[model samples]
Target: MREVFWQLVRFGITGGLATLLYAIVYWPIATYAQKTWPLANSATWPVAANLLGYLAAMLSGYVMHSKWSFRGHGRRDNLARTGGRFFLVSLVSLGMNTFFVWLLTGPMHGPTWWPLVPIVFFTPLITFGLNRLWVFA
Candidate 1:
């Protein structure tokens, strides 16, 4: 129980860092894409930008999670296997985040920035569960 508590703490710290990295990469690229293709605001532009940002952060997140967050909790003998798991979880989470953004900003006609609400909040919690139960476990 204490271990789970400490692991969650590490996950929060690492997740926060990765989320910041994601926002930094996302805003500029997403802004540019939105500008370049205003008509595609409903999906293409945002999804692409989110994918790019997610991938960038996933790399750093994996290292932090492996070396710090879930350190000593699992076997790190083969990073390839572990990396595959991490990447799979991240990809799924990316798809989820992209869809939520589209739903909020496009169909729902919410504030353009409103998508960040789900991205910054829900997606991390979902990913953390997956990482804790599957990826890092």
Candidate 2:
């Protein structure tokens, strides 16, 4: 349907912006940590940094989604419910991203880009459905 198409478009744009924000924040911190600390070989820190960045970006995305994407859908009025749903879904998405990245990087012997690809491709789609049906609905 047209509604779903438009929703996907809006969600894509918002998700892209949020991810850009997260990368901007994450890269600098990750770079600093790698450079400043002696644990240059450690991969876990970047994962943690990514999680923090995602959380920050998710907050911005939630506000944008409430005002733009789900506006007038009768889902934006309940601040408490909206906030809770956003946080819950965001956390779950983060967990999924982490698990996926690990699976790709470890089990599949995939390239580093492989992990990032799924996060961008899949997480937003899943998050949008959750927002529309449970959070904002």
Candidate 3:
């Protein structure tokens, strides 16, 4: 319904903001660490960078989602429940992202169009439902 649409819009906005934050803050750090550390190989570097970026975004997103996206939802008032639910959602999202990135890089041979394609495509659909019905409700 209308509420669902609004929720989706809100999630989209929140996701955009979180992605911006991740790209702005995490990208340089990831790239620098990758070059400076010399621990991971070229193939492993993207995955490691992505993991760091995802973690940073998730931390920022949890706060933004609680305060902005799901503000009216009383579930966010309960810090533990809200945080736990967010964590659960994030875990699923992380798994999905990892799988997609692995498939793209490993099997698909690195299209390099947008490394965040999986997140951009999948997270909104799945997370919006979870946030509305489970976390926010």
lDDT for predicted candidate 3 compared with the true structure: 0.72
Error of 3 at 48 (Å): 1.0
Predicted structure 2, TM vs. truth:
0.83
Could you give me the TM-score of model 1 versus the true structure?
0.88
What's the lDDT for all of these models? 0.83, 0.76, 0.72
By TM-score, the best candidate is 1
Which regions of candidate 1 fall more than 4 Å away from where they truly are? 36-43
Best by lDDT: 1
2 or 3: which has the higher TM-score?
2
Over 4 Å off in model 3, which ranges? 24-39, 111-113
**TM-score-best of 1 and 2:** 1
Q: In model 2, what lDDT does residue 97 have? A: 78
| lDDT tens digits, residue span 109-137, model 3 | 77433556766776668877887788778
Displacement of residue 68 (Cα, Å) in model 2 is 0.8
Query: Comparing candidate 1 with candidate 3, which one achieves the higher TM-score?
Result: 1
RMSD of each: 2.1, 2.4, 2.5
Per residue, candidate 1 scores C-alpha lDDT tens digits across 21-135 of: 9888877776677676677743566667778888889999998999999987878788788899999999888888888778876789775567788888888888888988888
